[model samples]
Target: MKDSFCVTVTGQSLIKNDVRQIQHKRFLEVLDFLRQGNVVFTNFESTILGRYGGWPTKGRYFDYSRPEMLDALQTMGFNALALANNHAFDLGPAGVLSTLGEVWSRGFLHAGIGTDATDAMKPGRQRHGGHDVSLFAMDAGPGPGNMYAEDRSNGRPPRPGVNQLKTVRKLGVTKESFRTLAMLAQELRTSSLELTNYAQPDDPTAVIGENELNFYGTVFKQGSAFRRHVEIDPENAGEHLAAMQRAAARGDFVLAYLHHHHWEPGWQEVPGWVQGFARACIDAGASVFVSHGAPVLQAVELYKDAPIFYGLGNFLFHVPAEETEWSAREVWRSLVAACRYNGSGQLESIDLLPIVIGGEEETAANRLVPLAATGEVARNILQGFAKRSSIFGTEIAISGASARVSLAAARKVG
Candidate 1:
C-alpha cells in the first residue's frame, strides 16, 4: 500500500501575550484551512513551559498560556511545531527543557530543539499519505540564543528585559548563527578547502591569525564542548546528506525546513543564501525547501522537482505598538505562495493563502489566543488583515471585501 499525502507547512511570527490565548487563536486560524487529507503545522513561536524560565523585570520571557495553549493548537488543527526558531531560547536552557516537556506532554511533533547542537539538528520522520518523510532544522546564520536571565530566583533565572526590537520578533539567525554560515560560505567561495587566495596561509598577519575558538570565530579549547557559534559542521552536514539520500530512496518525498543566515536585517524581504541552500537541498534529493525569517513574501521558483519559497511572511505576531514594521499584516502584505504536493508523488501547485492573524476580541491580549475551532471568524479577519498590517507598512485601506495597501502608506522595510 503506497499512499501519498500533502501537508500545509507555515511559519509563525511571535507569541506575545498569554501562551494559552495565542495558542487558542492560532488553532482557529488553522482549522479554517484544514482539509480531510491535509495537515496544518507551524512553529510554536514561544516559550511558555513554566515559571522557572520567566525573565525578571521587563523581560516577559514571551510566555503564552501553557497546557491550554497546546490544547488550543491541537484543537485548531495544528499537528506539528518546529522549535528551531530564535525564541526557543527565551527562557534559556531551562526554558528549552520545559518546552521540550510541554510539546511532549501535548503530543505535538517538534524539531530544532535539544540539550545541545547534536540534539537540536537531529531529524524526525512522520507517516502520512502511506509514506514516511523526515524534517529537520539547521541554524545557518548569526543570531543570539535566548537572552540569559540576569539574576537567579526561586531556582529560576531573571529574564532579560525586553528591548523592543529583541522582544518583538526573531528573524531566526544571529551573529553566532552567521559565524556558522561564514564557514559554509567558505565551502561555496572555495570549491576546494585548499584555496588560499581569499585566506592567506603563510603571512603572520595574513588572516588575522585569530584563534578558531569555534564556528562563531570565537576562542575554543581542547576540552570545551559548546562554543558561542554552532552550525551544521562538515561532518554533520555530510551525515544529513547521507540521511536525506536514504530517505529519497525509501520515502515518497523529502523536505528540508532550513533557516539560513540573513544577509540583511529581518524587516526587508529577499533571498538569504536561498539559492545556495535550496540548490544544495535539491542536490541532496529534497522535494521542497521552505526558507523563513524574512519580513515579507519572496519569490518561489521550482528548482528541479522541489519548490523553494524564498521566505514566507508572518502567520502570527505580538503587537509591539512601538515597532511599526514588525506587525502582522505588514509582514502579510505580499501574497504568500504554498507548494502543494498533491496526491501524486510530485510537486503539484503553488497557490496564495493570505495568512490570517490577530484573533478575536481585537485586543492586544487576543493576539495571544488561538483561533476558534469553527474559525468562521477568520473571514472577518482577512477583511481587515491588510489594513491592520499596514500599520507596520503605512496607512492601509480596506474596502469592499479585501485590504488595499498604498505605496507611501505601507510599513517601511529596512
Candidate 2:
C-alpha cells in the first residue's frame, strides 16, 4: 500500500463499564500514525462472545466493550489480533466463537485459537502499508483458548483463546492447597479491578467464559498436573527461523508472538522454558518475540540480531499512577528504554502489551483531567525505554500516551 509500518498489537482488555470511552480518541491517534497503510493491531484481551458464559470460575469475566467493540477496532484500522492471551477463553468455546466470528467477520488476522494445539499454534498474517507480516502464536501458558478443535472423535487441542495446561508446578494438590490455588486462580482471573467482569446492578454484561478459579480447583483435585508437553517441537524453531529468513528476504520484517509470560519471578525468575522458547522462536527467523503473562516486564535480549521484549507491563489498564506505584510505571518505562527504533522515532520494534483494559472510569466527569489520555502513555513509554537502555546496552526509545505507548527503536548488534 504505502510503506511498511508493522504495528505489533496488544491491549489488556478494552472492555469495561465504559469501554467505549477511549475507543474513538485512541483509534484516531492510532490512525494518525498508521495512515500510511500500516496495520494497527492489538491483543483482543476481552472476548467478543455472542452468548454470555458467566464469569470465570476464578478470574473475573468481562465482555468486549460493546458489540461495537469490533466496529471500533475496524474503524480504528486494525488488521490483526492475538487470541492467545490468557483471557481469550474467559467464557469458553462459545466465547472463542464469538470473538473469532467478530474478528474474522470484520476481516482481521489472528493466531493461537482453534479446537486443538495445532489450531492454536497456527500462524496468521496481514498486509498493510506495503509490508507483509507473518505472526505465529502458541499457549506457552497463556491463550486464545480455542486450541482444541470441534472434532469429538479424537483428543483435540484446547480452545484457541484458552490455554490448557497439563499442570503448573506452583499449583499443589492438597485441600488447603486447593483452597489456596483456587484463590490464586481467582486472583489471576480478576487481577484488574477496572476490566474484571462483574455483573452490574443495571447493565446486561456477560459472565466470564473460563472459570480459571474452578478450572484450577479441578486441576488440584486431579493432583498436581503439568501440560502434556505436546512438543510444539523445538524443531519448529528451525522452521520458523527459516520462515523468518524468507520473510526478511522478501519483506521488511518478520515478527513472532509466542505465549511466553515474561513476568512472575516464580516462573521467569528461573525462566528456563521461556528462554528456550525465545531462543527457538528467534532462531526460526523472527525479528522480535513479544510476550505477556509475566504480569511484570522483563529485560530485552538480542538474539541472532533480533530483539526480544521479555515482557511489556500494563498497557491498557490504568493503575493508581501514584508515586508508590512508580515502579509499575517504571516497568513500562523500562520497556520503552529497551524497544528498538530506527532513527525515525517510529517504533521499529515489537514488545509485549501486558494488561490492556477498557475504560477510564475515574475521569468520566472531568474531560480536562490529564488521566483521560490513553495514548499519552506513549510519551512516558519512550522515556522509560531511554532510562533502561543502559541496562541492556542498546538504543531503544519509548513514548507514552496516557495508557498507550508509541515505541520506536533500532536494532544494535555487538
Candidate 3:
C-alpha cells in the first residue's frame, strides 16, 4: 500500500459552461492545488442537458450544463464526484440519465443518481493510492416526490432520479397555539379527507396524528415550546448506513456526502439534527463526512478521528447574471480541504486552503473561477472558519495564508 492517501474535498460546483480556456493566474494556482490530491472530490451540482435529452422542469431559475462542463471539471483535477443535490433534477428524469451517461463515460467515480432507488443507493467505488475508496451521496430533501428515485413494482417501470435521505418537517407549537390552528382548520373545512382528494397521487396528504394536525401537507405537533423540527426517516437513514458499513467491512475508505436545504434561522448555524447524523456516519465507518446546501461555511467537527465538514459553501457558483439573490460575499467564500490518511487507513491530518470564487474582482468574466485567498482576505476567512470550528471543540491553526486542523490534539482528546 502507498504510504499515504490524500483526498481533497471542495464545495458544490454549479458550472454551466466550459471553463478550460481561462488562464487567470490565481485560477491556475487553485487548479495546481487540486492536483496534489490522490482522489480529488467534489459535488457536481448541475444536471446535464445533452444526448439523453431533457426539458426545463422549473418555470424559472432552473439550470442545465453542457456535457463539456464535465471535461472542465476533469481538467480542474476532480476524479470523484457526488451527483446528488437540489439542482440534480432541474431538467427532470432525462437530466438524471444525461448526467449519469456523461459522468460514467468519463470513467469518473461517481454516485447518488441512478435509474432506480436500488441503483441510486449503491456506493461509487474506485482504487486510488493503492487503497479502495468508496463514496456514498444522498440528498435530504423537501423536493417533489417524483424527484427521488423509485424502484419498479407490479407492472410499473422504475423512475430515474437522485438518492434521497427522506426527512419530515414538523412545526412544533404550544398547546394553546395548536388548538387555535386546529380550530382554524376545522372552520375552513380543510380536513384530512378534503386535502387528500386534492392531493396528487405521488404526494399524498399527511396523516393526522393523535396529538398532531395536518395543515395541508405540513404537520404541526403540540409541544412544550414552539420550534421547527426536521427528522430523518429511519428507513432511509438505515439503508444508507448499511451501505456505508458494507463498504467499510471490505476495508475501503468511505466518504459520506449529504446535500440538504434545511437551513436554520441563521444560514451559517449548524442544525442539531445534522450534527447527530454526521456523528452517526462517523460511527458507521465513514472516513470523512461532508455536506453542502446552505451556501455558507459552517462548523467543522472531528469525531472518532473523522472530520465532519458541515458546509463548505460554493466553489463554482455559476448562476444567471440576473440572479442577484446570490450576491452575498459569503456565498463566494469557501475552503478546499485535503485529508491525508496513513497506509493503515487512519486519518493523519487535514490542510485547509481558503479560497474565494472570482477572487477580489467579482466580475462576470471571473465568476466561475476559484482563486486562493490571500493577505487580509485569507486571514478573515480563516478567522471566521476557526470561530465556527471552535464551537465543535475543534482547533484550527492559522499560519500566514492557510490553516490546518490540529488532528493530533483532536485525536488525543478522542
Candidate number with greatest lDDT: 3
Report the lDDT tens digits of candidate 2 across residue range 143-224: 2223233334456434334433221323224455556666666676676633233422212222223222334212224234
Residues 1-414, candidate 3, lDDT per residue (tens digit)? 566889999989999878899898888888887888999999998999988898887766699899999999999999999999989999999999999999999989999999999999999999988888899999998778888999999998999999999888889999999999888878767444465654555565354566788876778889999898888888889889988999999898899999999999888899998998899898999999999999888879999999999999999989888887888888888889999889888888899998999897666667778899999988988899999898898999999989999987887787
lDDT tens readout by residue for model 1, 1-414: 344466665556454443433334445444454433344556666666574564422253344435456665666566667666556565566666676778778766566666554455556567655656676554454344233222345885444311111111122344564466557756755665443443332211112133332222233322224322222345546666676777787753666665544534434434434566567777888877776666555545455655555555555666466555444444533332344555556555543344434433444444443343124343444334333333333333433323323333221331
Badly placed stretches (over 4 Å) of model 2 are: 1-5, 8-11, 17-31, 34-37, 51-66, 142-253, 260-262, 266-275, 295-302, 318-383, 397-412
RMSD of 1: 13.1
Considering summed lDDT, which 10 consecutive residues are worst modelled in model 3? 190-199
Over all chains combined, what TM-score does candidate 1 have?
0.60
| TM-scores, each model vs. reference | 0.60, 0.59, 0.96
Question: What residue runs in model 1 are displaced by over 4 Å at the alpha carbon?
Answer: 16-30, 35-37, 51-65, 145-236, 260-268, 322-329, 332-338, 342-344, 359-414
Relative to the true structure, candidate 3 has a C-alpha RMSD (angstroms) of 1.7
Write the candidate numbers in order of decreasing lDDT: 3, 1, 2
Worst 10 residues of 2 by lDDT: 364-373
Relative to the true structure, candidate 2 has a C-alpha RMSD (angstroms) of 11.1
Model-by-model lDDT, in order? 0.50, 0.47, 0.89
